[model samples]
Target: MSDEQDIQARAARGWRLWLVFLLLVLIGLAISGKMLTLNMQEQAFLKRQGDARILRTAVIPAHRGVISDRNGQPLSVSAPVSTVWMNPQEFDLQNASIDRLASLLGSDRAALLSKVSRFRAKQFLYLKRQMTPAQAVQIEALDIPGVYVDREYKRFYPAAEVATHLVGFTNVDGKGQEGVELAFDDWLQGVPGKKLVMRDLLGRTVKHIRELEPMSQGQDLQLSIDLRLQYLAYRELKAAVQAHKADSAAMVVLDAHTGEVLAMVNQPSYNPNDRSNLGAGMESLRNRAVTDTFEPGSTMKPLTVAAALMSGKYQLDSVIDTSPGYIRVKGKTIRDHRNYGELDIGRIITKSSNVGVTKLALSMHEDAVRNTMQNVGLGQVPGTGFPGEQAGVLPYHAKNRLVERATMSYGYGLAVTPLQLAQAYIPFATGGLTRPVSLLKLERPEPATRVMPEAIANQVLRMMETVTQQGGTGRRAAIEGYQVAGKTGTAHKVGSSGYEDDKYVAVFAGVAPVENPEIIAVVMVDNPKGQEYYGGEVAAPVFSRVVGGALRMLNVAPDNWKPATQVVMQ
Candidate 1:
């Protein structure tokens, strides 16, 4: 029995030992498997961790598109510049070298310290932007740790103040803020790229790894403006504004056949290259020709005449009595410079008779008159895609009081931008056809829509020609060698009070060479302080000078080279 007990205990001990051995082997296999897995992925994981510390992704800025005139003269261009930035965390703000860094960056020591301390938690901070090559080299030679330079493009307007109103200016970060820059931002801005690079402990790039994306330059944009014409207009408008001591002025010249803006210039212009005055009032920045509205005054008479003619109730020979030279409508008196006893339609335009125009306008239906104004693009944006374009005010049919209707006829109780006024005269220039206005160069001149009968337009054209001839209000607008047709407008400015007798917006709109119209030029001189404040005195001369030069530039042979017949009526 003792021998049996001993054998059983031995057997139990032996089985326990075998089971323990199997468990040990299984544990060893699990350890070996985990070790094998770690062997496979550990190096990659550690490499990634290290790379995260030393490798940096750098941005490569793409160049913005060039803005050019129709003649391919660059209006706005991108100049290469360097921006210095730094990792505030990696930089030692307390280091003595920071003093030199501040000096080179055009920053004081205290300001530099404050900037770095304020952005201590930030990974990146711009030290300076748009540094010249020499400026960049000076900073790089200082070799301050964690400071890095980035390449970017800065916009430079070649025409400066001459074209700044139309080309506009950009922000420090290369964003468009006004004018054409804001209008076509997406088309003008470019796509940025990135690259992975190895950096030292101090955040200085040591070696390039690979490009993550390629930068694509923006497309070039060609404007409908002819730079020569633009300069010409600017020169003339600036001279006029300064000569008259006017508050401000604007001028627009359009290709009569195509409605493409050949030149649009504004006075009191600013230099886009110099941004120190950016915070100034909007008066300096606004493209007043398209953005500002005014009571168009007599520049609106042609449309009124066209509407009267369109009604089939009037002809160029239609006569209206103006014996008193003033007429009362709705208790509001409308007057001309003088009371011409009786005037025909042609003589009315030639004399710029307010009573004559008011009588003619009253004879037509309201809808007919309003439709003519609307069809000529008044009270609506010209669809030039220009930023901040105003749709000038016009009374709705429901609100067309007799007073308002009468006032609208003689260019009151309604407002229009200079561009809109120029667009309105397009029908007269194009023989009753109105072309869509554009800022971008078209593949071809846009198709035209007939706004009035050819005969009516021709008759209006002949009347407008008489305006540049004798007895016309716009005689000053006539070029010596060419017949001109346009109306002079002298609107009493409507202020917080009813109407300021002292303030006026003098305007002239005309199409030159009555036989064959090539361009329409509109000029508006605001609040001329001199004694000569009439449109013929202030604005007409500007139109005459600008359009005359433009016609010669375009090489349009003059039909009135023989000299115009003169008829002077005060």
Candidate 2:
């Protein structure tokens, strides 16, 4: 509009433009300086904030120990497994995602959704535990948010039900639950470790930074059981139980010299691996040999005879009159199977004479029979370290009642576990030395305590030797090529009212190769329902087969081999 005025205005506008450009340059320079300060001075703080979102301290699982039998056979072991978990707070619980996860885990869709929704505030929740690696892979393929997989160990029992009662089982978290597993849990458990790791937004580990603590593995254990003998004993005992239609059964085989349990087994067992039926009942989980107790019955006769001998009132040649087949003590009559006019101590034991043994008890000090029983580990724990081992009832009556003494002398008025009964007979097997029972393998025999005089033990052992000979009660216990010394027992089970006439516990206990004793076995059949319920019929045969096999398996030289008849072909 006006050249001169426009010129002045243009000059002012140019100056204003130049001033604005300079101010813009200063602002840019100031911003660049602040950024440089942050990069060099506050870099560590920013890095820490970034790491808090993606870095994590991850757990390194430790491996559990192996359990083995004395022969180095694995009874229980551990295997690698995967556990799938999720951060419920970060999870997107969409219908599609829930359906897919539930289907993959074999879980109900409604239950899975409700569980996630209920614990939405939780940081960690298990989706499925102890899954296979293949299963974990399928889950990870879903690529769902907040899901994670962790490596862990799951217990696997290789011996299955056969060794379950001895080796026991563990929980999903690798904690021992029963038997030797529970008894030695701490020794078999491992200490887990930790490490610094970086993870992605999807809860997957990207990198391991450094280890915080090293994992400590558990120590292995070896039990005293010989698997071979265990299998043999189990097979034979199971057969006997089923054949007899018995309520239950238990058997134990021990090294007579060392007192180490070679084999221990019970009926109505369960598989530790397949625990689907664990909630059914605890009946099958019991170790009857160590946990159950029964009246020892006539099995107590040998010990009673030993008591009489120890009292210096009876000898190997001593005679007792068992006339009229029975005797009365305080209105309680004790009777023999039949009358045997008069018999020596040896014949008394051979025939298992209740009246003879009762006379022996009536004549000695009242405490004599009870003292002999307690001295040989009765009325006390067997010291086997097994969980739930019972100290069976050995009744003590201070009134010195004749009925009590007479009944107690012939193996009544007291209770004993099958294991305790096995241990009690050890003194007779080892010349009166009572070696401590062991459940763990030993390099050598343990020291023994003298429970009775050596001479008395040998004399009693000789008397027992006749029991397995012709016309003796335990004749069925005799082996083809070995001498056996043992006793038979048949006792009526005590009921709520009185001794039950319908229920009977048949038992047989014996030592083989009697000249130089090697193995001792005890067989007990509870409540046999078959026609024959006596110890000689139901239990002695099992002892014979088991001991006969064991003696041959150990290459023990037979002490009673007879000359084979040579017949010429005519």
Q: What CA root-mean-square deviation does each model show from the true structure?
A: 8.4, 2.0
Error of 2 at 316 (Å): 1.1
Model 2: per-residue Cα lDDT over 291-389, one tens digit each: 999998999999999999999987778899999999988787788899987999999989999999999988888789999999999999998778899
Error of 1 at 344 (Å): 1.2
lDDT scores for all predictions? 0.88, 0.90
Tell how far residue 43 is off in model 1, in angstroms: 1.5
Instruction: Report the C-alpha displacement of residue 447, candidate 2, in angstroms.
Output: 1.2
Check candidate 1 and list the clashing pairs.
325-339, 470-567, 471-567
lDDT for residue 283 in candidate 2, whole number 0-100: 92
Worst lDDT run of 10 residues, candidate 1, spans 395-404
Local lDDT at 493 for model 1: 95
**Model 2 CA deviation exceeding 4 Å by range:** 1-30, 33-37, 95-97
Cα RMSD for predicted model 1? 8.4
How does each model score on TM-score?
Answer: 0.90, 0.95
